[model samples]
Target: MEIPIYIFYALLSAIFAALVAIFGKIGLEGIDSTLATTIRAFIMFVFLLLVSAFQGKLKGGITSRQFAFIVLSGVAGALSWLFYFLALKTGTVKAVVAIDRTSVVFAIAFAWLLLGEEVTLRAFIGALLIVIGAILVSLK
Candidate 1:
């Protein structure tokens, strides 16, 4: 049996995301959370810029609508990082990450509501389980 390529990418993303929580917590110890987050975002921007340039992905022309949505997404992502870093700075990583992972449920709801994506019964049940698990894990 063959696994889809996206599953592999998703697994890698999960690993890196876990590392982000640990590393961000340690790095936030002496610095302001907002400053730490800003530095991290800059690093990410530079790294992604290099990667896109190397991959020849920087040549594509984006439509105005696409550009507008991308800008909105960037703003949303910045807010997410700001809050996440602040949470990591003040809270236990286990609890913080547990709550942060609930973004999966948010994404599902947004997809269904804004994108007209169908939420299958299985997917809905899985999302509910994730919320329950997050709450359990985040408990004191």
Candidate 2:
């Protein structure tokens, strides 16, 4: 829940993501990207379920509203994956990831405006650098 924890998580996500790109590129050498994605999704689903059970968080207490939101989240995830796969087909994984990671900018802006979070100079600087880096990467 802390900001630093989020940053650590993001860094770890980036590391895993690099591995994903390399592995996916190799895995899809002959198979279609869609098939590869489906396989990965299934594995991820199983792992997430196991993690949820391990955390004792799946006590069959989900409300209908929670179920709705969970389904919506899954829908959004699928849509995101569709676009990501399409991007991977045409662009280097690095470029796609660079652009995708700019979601941090949106998160910062949203927190500042909607959540009333403090807009620290460090956060502003980091967001600026990230956007500029993404632009540089996108320029070819």
Candidate 3:
């Protein structure tokens, strides 16, 4: 994909995610978080399935390695959501979200150390900025 297209997708994803967190907190007023997560998963699965089908790529030929990766992704996603919802339950939305977005710093560090991604000074500076912004947003 083109660079602009990727940026567009990222922007939309971030916006949608922020909206999800806000609405999710409101919707969780009378529902269990775990159940709510499962329902959201079901909805996402359906949407993804439709997209795959429309693209003529609906196939389930998963190898063990691919299966493991998928499982790990799902586990990480569930854990993240669990913590997000729990935090939202007890903390302010802005604080919970700002803290949660700290994953960008974590991602940068892990990618550098584990995946051997390039650890340029620029990347370090960007991560620092993200952390600073998160801290400022979470301040009372």
Candidate 4:
């Protein structure tokens, strides 16, 4: 059976996420977290623009609702990065990443509550296990 393309992208994202923590930690030695985040965001913006342009995906025809949601998502992502960098600045990478990964559990809950997504028993159990693991890893 062939895996989906999204799986490969997700795998790559995970790999880059690990690299981001290491690189961000090293690069943040004497820098403000907000400034570091801004620089990183700018680099990401340029890279994504290049990719979008290369793929001819830069058309601007989104609906107002789509634009609003995209703006909201960008703001939320910026806030998440800001807090994540702040945490990483003071916390060990392992613990910080572990705690951050608990966003999966939060996503599950939010999906069920806000998106009306199904929350099966198995998924609930898995999310519970993730919660437990995150808590264990976060303990000093």
Candidate 5:
């Protein structure tokens, strides 16, 4: 069976996210976590802006509702990063990241509630196991 391209993209995102934990922890050695996160966010903004421009995706035609949602999403993401960096500053990478990965479980629940998406039994089981695994990994 052919694998979906999205799976590959997801895997790549996981890899880079792992690197973020490692690198962010190291980079937090002498500076404040919030400062580090701000700098990192700036770099990310520039990189994504360049990529979007390169792909001709910089056109602005979104409605106010769409703009509001996008801004809210950005705010949520920024808060996530700020807290993540703060955690990484003092916590073990494995423990911090394992706890952070619980976002997947949250996403599942949120999707079902907010987006009216169906949660299958298999997916529920997977999310349950992920919670268990994260707890085990996060334990001292």
Candidate 6:
């Protein structure tokens, strides 16, 4: 059976996310968390722009609604990163990341409530397990 292309991308995302914590922790020493986050965001913006330009994918126009939602998402992402860096500054990366990953549970609930997506019993159970695991890992 062929796995979906998205699965590969998701795996890459996970790998890169782990790297972010390690690298960001090292980079945050003697730096403000907000400043570090801004620097990271700037780097991401430039890289994304270069990739989009290289791929000729920058010409598309977006609707106002699309623009609004995208901006909202960016803001939410920035806030998440800001708090994550703050947490990492004072906490162990393992515990911080484990707790941060509980966002998946929030995502599941939000998708079901806001997007009207179906939540299977199995998914709920899995989310519950994640919560338990995160708690276990977070405890010293």
TM-score of each: 0.97, 0.75, 0.89, 0.95, 0.97, 0.98
Task: Give the C-alpha lDDT of model 1.
Answer: 0.97
Q: Which whole-number lDDT from 0 to 100 does residue 70 have in model 1?
A: 98
Task: Assess each prediction's global lDDT (C-alpha) against the native.
Answer: 0.97, 0.82, 0.88, 0.93, 0.97, 0.97
Tens digits of lDDT, candidate 6, 5-123: 99999999999999999999999999999999999999999999999999999999999999999999999999999999999999999999999999999999999999999999999
Candidate 1, 6-122: lDDT as tens digits: 999999999999999999998998999999999999999999999999999999999999999999999999999999998998899999999999999999999999999999999
The collision pairs in model 2 are none
Q: Which stretch of 10 consecutive residues in model 6 shows the poorest summed lDDT?
A: 88-97
TM-score of structure candidate 2 = 0.75
Query: What TM-score does structure 4 among the candidates reach?
Result: 0.95
Give the TM-score (vs. native) of candidate 3: 0.89
True-structure lDDT of candidate 3: 0.88
lDDT score for candidate 4 against the true structure: 0.93
Q: How much is 134 displaced in model 1, in angstroms? A: 0.5
Please identify which of the two predictions, 3 or 5, would achieve the higher TM-score against the true structure. 5
Superposed Cα deviation of residue 122, candidate 5 (Å)? 1.1
Regions of candidate 6 where Cα sits further than 4 Å from its true position: none
Q: Count the backbone clashes (under 3 Å) in each candidate.
A: 0, 0, 0, 0, 0, 0
lDDT of 4 at 61: 86
Q: Considering every candidate listed, which one attains the maximal TM-score?
A: 6
lDDT of 3 by residue, 55-117 (tens): 989665889999998999999998888778878877789988988998999998999889999
Backbone clashes (count) for model 2: 0
Displacement of residue 103 (Cα, Å) in model 2 is 1.5
Candidate 1 residue pairs that clash? none
In model 3, where do residues sit more than 4 Å from their true spots?
1-3
